[model samples]
Target: MSDAAWPAPPQGSCTLPASVEAEVAILGAGIHGAALARELTLRGVTCALVDKGEVGGGTSQWSSQLLHGGIRYMLTGDIRQMREGLAERATWARIAPRRCRWEAFWMPHRYWAEGLAHRVGIGLYDHWGAERPGWPAGLSLGHVPKEAFLADPRGVLGPFRGATAYADLMTWDRELTRDLAASSEAMLLDFHEPEGFEQGDGGLKLLHLRDRRDGSARQLRARRWVFALGPWTDGAMAQWFGETRKRLRLSSGIHLWFDAVPGCERPWAIRRPKGRILFVVPRDGLLQVGTTEREVEDGWVPILEAEREELFGALEANLPSLPWREMLVWAEELGVRPLVAATGATTHLSREAVLERHARIPNLTLVLGGKLTTARALMDRLATDLTGLRCEASTTAPLRLWDGQAAEIR
Candidate 1:
């Protein structure tokens, strides 16, 4: 779909005013910043949300677009992350039903032992969200018949024990991010980059912003500031605050798109030799197969020939019968996910958001390591921590986006 099909910005303009003042200045217009703008504006706080590029034009557009409740995280005993994801999934379904729809995710197992573990893990996942209203029930785990499994003959590995199927929500991550930013009362400044900041009187932050279209500059002042730079968190911190100790460990992920697999409408979670999960999602008549996680020295990772070869090998190993070469190579996306720096493989990094308050800068906050699924909850927590305002009542209230579509939370 063309960009025109989605809702336009509420301000209908990205032109920066000469001077603007607000209660908060949010840097980075990705999903996190957009969601924070919505949450803050609803609480009667004026905000200025500035982005170096178009809103959601960065890594937000390159997400897997699954509103899943982190089913894989359950294996690691990350119950809090799983529960937050479940609640956020339901919230997105309520407010953006048109944008979200249910898809059955299949986890095929090659060994009985692995299948048993999968069944037990999925059972726990299903039970965790049982009390949440409007959630899907009756998730089943069973063996797949040989004939049924071979029906598609595309990317389906044979001699498997069985599969576990469960429902998860999917949406257009870019559109949702745009809608949240455009609909908020906050001033959305696209194509504006933050040059630096200066400490102001009464603990106010004076931000210097530059227009990317032209060389013009503007000044913005706010009581509090948030840096939601996503993968650029470390760079922004070093450039602006000059106090960076490597708070985030960046991992690069790549997704390749092809024409929809003939009969593979439902998404599949295929396990790789390294025990990592690769998702093959079908959406909008396109088949998206991805996500290889590897630590990166910087954020400028691209889709190299080795990555393409790896994907082709995966397809050949799993679904040897499918003519993968014949499928149209639609597009490719590369994104960097900020993970908490720790000793382990990049695949084992937690997906939780990290909120760091500057020791010297009292009113400044740095947001890092978050997922698109939990942006709203993360922002709510940040708002409460910064402003001491509670959003208990608004949790059940319908959230209206840029197009004036109300998402009923109840």
Candidate 2:
């Protein structure tokens, strides 16, 4: 039915969705869309979130699992992005203690000179957190042992140098994803993949959905549509002429899990000789590890044994005392980071605000690369601009996620 002929549902109340109506139809039920769902519902907007698979089943679950400040981001001096992210980090920590909790991350420095540079950088972190509520202060470590992390063999060792501790939060992405799905009255359909759709009347967006579970198909119409589809968003915008897949550059990252790592529960960051930054994150009960950033062409590879092999070697070389062979077998997972790049920028681009309306889809908005800490802020901006009905976003402050307390919000 044409939008004008179809009966319109009341703005504040949901009427059955016509087996397909939504005030806001957000694509991809991962963190990006999930968080947006929560905020929209809190604002009383009727939202329908659709995912090809499970909610939070995407890379959101496979993240480095850090709700960390932009320490790496700070390296580029993206002040506006850093400050805003710190705020969101604090908020996520406050609300979601179950799945999101604060933990201290250590980056042990070997060279005295490099230590000095890190000290200055950490000082900036401390200063940044001083104005914010949830961030913790960076602590300086004196001399330590080679096997200090013997408790967690997957951790950094050697050089007997001091370590610095900075504040960061980690969360169970899946639990948080589930929490968001539960918190919203918004209809979230899993495995109901979008087949495609034509632009609707009056700038409305329509989607042809296939309920993969039952092999049933239907069309969904919405006043506004959101493409928070993570990495796949690059291809989903194909129907539009003006939009280019170049709008986003996908990055591949890998992580290994092992409980064998010896050390304090405090997470630590280690600088590899290759100018790469790696983290040995302590999550829930598993020792999670990861992350080399490399650009991608147009393919999705599940797990790369090469990445695991190289990363394992790196960890073993850095910490000789650990049983790398034994610990490496614990568990390994992989995923891609949906990175949005602006003109003349790369994935290493500044950790800044990436809220932009789709150049081609007038009724659609796209949220690009952002820190786990900044997702909420991104949601707030999205709601303010697209809701067409201006409502203040108190959410940027009220919701907290550290320790995964946000899971409880659901």
Candidate 3:
């Protein structure tokens, strides 16, 4: 990795503020921070946003890339959450259709005993969206594992059994984040690391930031701070919220990639027999396969695994006939998902993210545990809280900065 993979803020942009008109500073340029920045900037709030790494390069890049409404919640039979999630999921399709669009996912229908409950679940899923007779509203691909493939030996689960097709959005999540950051009036200050903070009379004050590329240092001042740092949310919380920062449980997930089959169509979120969902997500050239969750105690950093046997094991379990013999055309990657754990079922953690205000500091707000598909709606909630502000977003079409694509902050 280039030591300078991330760029420096525009020279002289970080000048220490003598006194600011507004009182809000948002720290950490992950997805949530970028969403907040766009919302606040459009509201004309005075704010300074900072990040330790490249904007949208952290967990945002690691997302499963599903702009889902909440199929997971549907399985739980929660109408309210399912309804809310579907609404949020649609917002992405509307705003960033280029970066986020709709996809039809398949839930295997075999194993009648196990899937009996699931059939009711997806029927509710279709009903929640008011699914149309055939699809979009709700479509069912007729069941049946293909006799040829199943008889061939390598086939694992099958359409031969059948699957329920559900609608969800496939998103270029990382790119959407970069676009959101660009939507903000706040200066896009990337590559600067927060050094420390001090408990001052006015509130918590950021001491300084270090430039990772040049070894130079600078200072920036803001009235208040917001922590949207993904899993790093914990560290920022511990620092400003006293030693009493709320707890967050983090985990790592991995996905494998394969070239689209001879003519496999759009994205397909396949439900495996083991309660794990592997996304058969489609991109221009490749299909995204993956995701096995492993818990991590501290989550401020990215996960790196040169060889993930277990991650692949799950994929192999799902895609039984994958041809390792073909050679030269598959990829595997793993990243951490920062989820707030709740009791009941592991996947049933509150889909609705929680937001809390700092007891000591009135302006600082901490937004925790949100799904990628719900970001725009999260901003909508922020707008609702602003009171008296028009909720209409700007005419600017949403964009996502995949890889290192850069955009001008307006």
Q: TM-score, each model?
A: 0.89, 0.82, 0.79
- lDDT ranking of the models: 1, 2, 3
Q: Residue by residue across 1-410, what tens digits does model 1's lDDT show? A: 12221233333334657888999999889999998998887787899998877888887888888887887776678888898898788888776665677766888878889888877887777677553345445433344555655675553555454677666788888878977786578887777767877786545468787776666788898889888988777776777667568888988888888887678856888777544778888877788888777788565566778878887777767667667778788998877788877888878888888898877777888898989899988898898887788876345555455553445311
Q: Tell me the lDDT of candidate 1.
A: 0.76
Error of 2 at 115 (Å): 2.3
Candidate 2's displacement at residue 255, Å, is: 0.4
What order do candidates take by TM-score, descending? 1, 2, 3
Clashes of 2: 39
- For model 2, residues 1-410, the per-residue Cα lDDT tens digits are 11221122222322333367888988878787888888888788999888777777766777777666667755666666666666666677666655666666677777788777777777778567653344444433333344554444434355635666666667767777767666677786666756767774456467777666556666788888887877666666664433454666767778888774445466778876434578877665677777765666442555666777788787766656667677545677666776666554344555454777755567877777665567766776787677645445444434333244434542
- Provide the overall lDDT of each model, using Cα atoms, as 2-decimal numbers: 0.76, 0.65, 0.61
lDDT per residue as tens, model 3, 63-163: 88776657766555566766876766655655665565555565654467645655677666756665221224333332323552344332344332545
lDDT of candidate model 2 versus the reference: 0.65
Top-TM-score candidate index = 1
